[model samples]
Target chain A: MDNKRRKFLKMAGATVLAGIGAPAVVKLTSVPALASGSEQAAAGHGSGHGEEQRTGIRLGMVIDMRKFYGNEELLNQAIAACHAVHNVPEIPGRKSEIKWIWKTGFANAFVAQSQNLRSETVKNSQFPVLCNHCDNPSCVKVCPTKATFVNEKNGIVAMDYHRCIGCRFCMAACPFGARSFNWQDPRPFIKTYNPDFPSRMRGVVEKCNFCAERLALGLEPACVEACQGTGAMVFGDLNDPQSEVRKVLSEEFTIQRNAAAGTRPSVFYIV
Target chain B: MIEKTLKGKPAYWIWLAILGTFIAIGWACYFRQYVFGLGLTGMSRDVSWGLYISQFTFLVGVAAGGLMLVLPYYIHNYKAFGRITILGEFLAISALVMCLMFIMADLGQPLRGLNVIFHPTPQSMLFWDMCVLWGYLLLNVLCGWVILTAERKQVPPPKWIYFFVAISIPFAVSIHTVTAMLYCGLPGRHFWLSAIIAPRFLASAFAAGPSLILLACLVMRKYAHFDAGKEAIQKMTTIIMYAVIINTFFFLLEFFVGYYSEVPGHIHSLEYLFFGLEHDGHVYNNLVPFMWTAALFNFTGLGILAYMKIAKVFDYRLVGTAATLIFLALWADKGLGFVFAGFVPNPLEEVTEYIPTLNELGITLGIWATGFFLLTLLYKIAVGIEHEVEA
Candidate 1:
């Protein structure tokens, strides 16, 4: 009986070791290959041409609230342009709303920056808030699948809707409340279908993708285009000192939504 | 051994039938949720996780609580716990099944549940949670079945079983710790951001888990004609006493840090839960009564337990009452209070109150029923085998 127990222990030990070690070995060997494959896929999908792919560029936005202050129409136009292009639903209730770009009061927009003694105009103003596309995005960090990931080449936080398990950990992790889940089939709510962009299904999380498709086609984001000439919204590489976004940042005193969150938001607001 | 579950008294079958009906109703509600999307639940964009996740969190503790028995019995060779160690393992098994079921029910795309495993991202705490939960489940199932089978054959479980037993000790701890990490690691959620969340989880888990085991033992004694032994019950009761005390202390620590520090982020959720937050003149205090009730039950249960321990009284009825109270207190504290409060005064600092829909409650009840159904079968088998061995 003792000998039999010893043999059984040996077999069990071997099986246990094999079970754990096998996965580790497979993960280690396959990781590099998978990483490269995903990068290539991202590059291919992000920009049709390799030359157009903005490498080493931290894509960011400068929402010059100075230009947008008291002009709710421009804010509405920007929201409409982005939502129309992205096929975001017009779900009425706040419970099942899907928004890529939206407007909120200054206090709601910048909880950390809002002061009790702020000027009436500043206090009353509404700000456009979207995904910050943070350099240290909490959403990406908590995503179980690499469904939502930072575009390493350009620093634009991106999403792969198909891969998303819709666990909403990202939604919880995101300090900005930028991400939205499709609580219902969003297709029925889309008033005018935009065939250019595919509508998300009921069980995926989506947010501002920084208009990766338009960027692929060598065009500015729809929101930026809609706000063109008004110069309310500037979309450019934050890495390039000469870029309009950087120029705006240099000239204006700007702040990020919840900078205290330590997400290092790419989107800045000039209050 | 498997056949033991097939033989049961009429009451046993009736109990199972009732559980089956709840399970059926829950399945029907879940089908509605799956068809219409998660819109059926009270969760909004702000409050993304709701009752399902809350139950998942609490059940993880209940599952981990099983370790209280396993560690003392196998590692320390506490012979009093010998007869009831399998009970702990079996309880853990059923609790984990409920945990997994809750997760599945909560998922937006249930079909894509395997995506976490298929593309494992180590950075995601959820991936680690999934890993640990599944690992713990497998370990318990293996250990419980092997040990129970050996006991049935009137032979010692092979020495090799000790290896799995040893692993499951930490595996049990890891399951709850990892589950805590899921909430605590998030950046902006102030309620879950505290360092003590993991320790508090273990404390409550230890309390809740053993309280449940004691209750089960009581039931088994009366109905199933199985006694877990007086010494074993006494030891377990003592463990619960300390555990409940520690759990309450940990919560007080959180309350002190939140209130004394005067951080709005920290205090808002707690205030919302207990006293109700005054937002724009209207007090959003839906959870206030529930929170106070939990507190009352917790303190009252602690009082009873302390009295019993100090007075050296092992009155079964009093012990049973204390156990039930402690279990319910911990359930409300960890389940409803913890998860819901975290989402309140959301990251945007907006109050979007979430009240689970009737369908949602139906689904929640169903999952719990499914868990009890599993527990009944597993315990029936274990007790039946023990009875046969004695006969």
Candidate 2:
């Protein structure tokens, strides 16, 4: 009986370890560009710790609000693309609607920065705001169930809808108001169902997952891909200094939403 | 003694029936809400938390308020409070029930609430709140029941029960402190993210909790021929007066810091509550009247309290009126107003108005009915025992 009990415990430990370890191994082995000199050079921090370092990719976005100034249609298209791919519901009315990405005025977007003497174009610019996916995410920290967590592999904040208790503590904790709770069943409101992405139930909180799903598919986020020709939005590894997002940040005077809140938002706006 | 409540007068049955009708209506509304999801409520992405959360916050203080009476009787050995400690404990039990119910009603997925327990994250204050509230409830139930049992048998409560009393005092403070932490730790919510929140919650709880108990005692006296002593009521009034003063002071400190520093984020919610604010060419004046009414009642109640304190005369009518007003003042301040203030100029910096829908009100009313129902029944048992002992 003792031997059987020990054997059962050993199997359980192995299963749990395998559940966690298998993903790490798969992620490390799958990234073919791990040893590339350019990738290493771009990853300037170079806190290289062998196998684990391969998945130390910090994903971020650079949104150029200037390009979206008068083109409401362009902004809509990009938002729609993301919503469709992510299976975000369109709950008709504004109140209970689910939004992954949406437009906001420049003043509201860069809340901490001075908007007193901005040019008319800058002031009126409609910036697409979404989850900042903060390096030190407050939502991730406050989530009672660990339903929302920062992916240690890629630094992308991800949500497990099934696990969310719908407490909205994460919603309150989020300084940027990036998170939204599914106030009702989201499935019916979805215009065109995307089987690739799962629809969340009424009680879970969800936000811009930084397109972790598409990233796994080795494709750009729907928003980034839709804004391909326009170059209004760019998504790349922030860890990679040579990446497009990093380059944009380096060249442009970019400002993050609620920077003073010290959340260290990953999403930067080139106003 | 326990069976005595079952043999109440016709008036008792009528009271129960009224509460039951409200509960039935509430449950029916809740069923519809359960089917349709939280969409039935006026809560949105902007005003994510509304009436339910606000009530939960207020009621946590109410539950903690039991400690004010409990500590004096048990810890301080203030024998004057001996008669009413059972009432306070029962009140705590009922208030905790309402607090838990409000939280359950507010959830987007009520069934998944166990997720907090299954995946316990101590870093989250909500988890801590759940632990302390449940523990506090259990403590009150055990201690109150044991003491009552001993009273019936004409014996002092067992020595082991004293240990629970010692634990209950600190545990009571923790419940409200953890509730305050739920709001205080949030960095973005300038209205709630303050050091004053915990102390203010305590003060408000001390004032509102005992004010409510004092009123309940008066009602019990009128209905059940139970007098909790004039001296006892006066002692409670003193507690309420000092606590309300401190509560008012703490509240003013927030206004002072917000205005004096000239920080837009800090002052914006206060401005929205008091004078109203405009967003995108539309003005939100909905909460302005409510805030002013609350302030009026608070000061008027304070005035009455001061008069009574100075005159050295205890007038139940004036004290009762003041208590009722103070209760309403705290209710309005802590309930939807405080909750709504945090979301004003929401995360997106938009002042989208949130008015509770009828469906939401139904659920809230139902929860209140449930609390009152519990209170009435528990008091019936407690009062029956008291009557039996007196005879």
Candidate 3:
């Protein structure tokens, strides 16, 4: 731990002089913002393990809210594609606690972002929220039983429903409320069951899969297919430098949900 | 002699009739539950768990409280309870079976109960709770069966039986404490988020379970001519008195923190429970009545049990009546109204609360009937062995 910190400080000091410090070498840095490079470089002091993944394979999305057109169909298609294939149950009267995909209205969607904003008139912000599939999902950490686990292979949070005790502690820990419980037997609502996905039984929790099955088949998520070519939604490998997702992230500034949490969500919003 | 042994008593006929009737009702409800799904119940997205979950919670408490009997008999070696420790073990087995039945009825898929074990999520308290309960139930059932088999032959078996009973003491408490953790661990949800949740659960279980045992002893005297002796009942009642004191204290703690500091999430659930949340159902009406009843039950029940002057003259019939009423009152307080009140107006603050529909209530009732019917049969078989041992 001590060696890790020293390596970060040394690299951060050099970066301040390398590119960011050149223009500021003559200017007296009155404000930290003016010497942004120093701050950014200073942050590098405590981190280098991230350098390889940051440049090589740190996959992510860059969402741009300014260009959003309040396209309801586009949002629904994305959710449907994932839900349909996952065999997400739709019970009649009792809502069986399984949600592979879902949606929220625009006002509630942007309420957190623009509720306190004074100047910006944030309109047409029909944002879509999913599991966010955080790099450090708290749900996985608090599970005493480890029923919900993060798959290192695909960065997907997976559930072995058989292992879940239906105690719903993960549901309580999750700030997103993304998880749902099976309140009763789920079979009646299964109008169509997909054999591709291993189905969950009642009395356990279920949530978004992020299309791990589709990824294994070399196809994008079902939601991606529904939004394809519309330009409303973009799907690409964040790990690949040539991928469209990475290109968008560079061209436009985007925001992630609950940055304060430091979960490092893969999803992004462009506003 | 074989014909006489096979011949049933009048009480046996009555027990069989009652058990058969409930079993039939349970079967009908289960069929509909499978056909219509959870939609038949009063529960909605906001309130995913309702009456059945509450009953499960209550039964877990009842099951765990069996330790009071164990503590006296095994821990203290009280001879007054010597003839009836097996009865406590059997009661625990029945109560746990009820707990499992309630959980099954509440599940979206009754068959997928094994999923908790097959695809275990270590993160869920629900999973831990399941493990503890399964372990406790298996322990009790094994103990009861072993004792019944050995006692039927009119002799004590190997010494390992005592060791098994001793091990189950803490194991039973673990089941209920884990159940309490299921709620207390939530980040918010004011009504249940308390550090004292597990303690309160144990206290209530101790109060309610031992009270039921007192009633059980009374019934045994009346039906089977077995006297648990007044001294045993009196001693058990003292333990119940202390447990009630602790339970009421923790309950007060929950209310004080909720209303005094006045956090919104904390305050909302109380108001939702007592005064009713603006958009939610009439749980306030149903729950407030029972909350007061529970208060009355706990206070007066403890009052009667604690005071030596009043308790000396206490008839077993009156004790049985009061204890059963108190047991059911607390059951309603924590089990029924509490559950509906917890989730009504939900996290999103959508969806109003309502009593379980006829369908939902019927299904829940069906599950109870199923549990009780099974309990009756198990008791009948055990009691028969006890009778044989007495002879």
Docking quality tier of model 1 = medium
Candidate 3 chain B: minimum summed lDDT over ten consecutive residues — where?
B1-10
Candidate 1 lDDT over A1-271, as tens digits, reads 3443233234324433464321111111112212322232223322423323323456788888888877888988999999999999999988999998898877788877646889888888888999999877889899999999987656789998899888999999999999999999999999999999999999899999988777665456889878777778877666544455767788988888998887878898888
lDDT of 2 at A183: 86
Displacement of residue A180 (Cα, Å) in model 3 is 5.1
Ranked candidates (lDDT, high to low)? 1, 2, 3
Interface RMSD of each: 0.8, 1.0, 4.7
Tell me the lDDT of model 2 at B127.
89
Residue B192 lDDT, candidate 3, scale 0-100: 69
Q: Report the error of model 3 at residue A256, Å.
A: 6.2
lDDT of 1 at A250: 89
Candidate 1 global Cα RMSD: 13.4
Query: Candidate 1 chain B: worst 10 consecutive residues by lDDT?
Result: B344-353
RMSD of each: 13.4, 8.5, 9.7
Q: How many residue pairs clash in each candidate?
A: 0, 0, 42
DockQ of 3: 0.19
**Residue pair clashes in candidate 2:** none
- State how far residue B383 of model 1 sits from its true place (Å): 0.4
